[model samples]
Target: MKRYAKAVWHGSGKDGSGHLTTQSEALEKNNYSFTSRFTSTAGTNPEELLAAAHAGCFTMKLSFVLDEAGYYPERLETTAYISFENGAITASRLFVAGIVKGISLVDFEACVLEAKVDCPVSMALNIAITTEASLTD
Candidate 1:
């Protein structure tokens, strides 16, 4: 299946504004701007959207990975932080917390590594990806 999103930017890059619209309109022409992207503005930006996508995709991949490894998590909370540097996105950090059982540390680490390589968003990002996970019984 193919999915898509569209970004519409108006005016110059430094003084411009834009909104992103998804095919399904779930985002519904949400606002983005240079100020929002570069500074602390109360608006949505590309980095924020990337963070959301990374977090969601990683969490789903982790869930599947854990299940395949014979561990079922009661809860999984993930955060993806995207860092923008020198006019480019340079890194992403995945922070995860969960309650799981039926797996050892080695197996869990292996599953996480697999997810890091296999998750669609992770694969799409051309940046460094790091992860931290805390699991409990």
Candidate 2:
């Protein structure tokens, strides 16, 4: 199976701006600019989009792990941060918290580690990936 996405950039990187549209169109012609990334702005940016994608992908992978372990988590919350520096993306951190009905900590840790290494997005990213997982009532 193959999946693909496309991005089009126009104008200069510093003073000018561009829009990003994905194959899914979830971000149809969304706006991006240097200020939105380097400074503070009210529009979207590459890091933000990457964070969203990582969080969603990690959560989905965790769900599959939970199902496979017969735990069936009640809730899985994940936050992903992508760090960019020197005009390059450097690292990604994934924080996950969940409430599960019948899973031991040992089992959960094992599953989380497996997902961290095996998740599709994790494989796609070309930077360091770190994860922290916790179980909450």
Candidate 1 has an lDDT of 0.87
> Can you write out model 2's per-residue Cα lDDT over 1-137, one digit (the tens) per residue?
76556666678888888788877787788888888888888668889988998899989998998898888889999999899989899999999898997787777888888898889989998899998888988
lDDT of each: 0.87, 0.86
- Candidate 1 steric clashes: 0
- List candidate 2 segments past 4 Å from native: 1-4
lDDT of 1 by residue, 16-128 (tens): 89888999898888888988988898679988999999999999999998887777878888999999888899999998877777666667667777988899999998899
Off by over 4 Å in 1: none
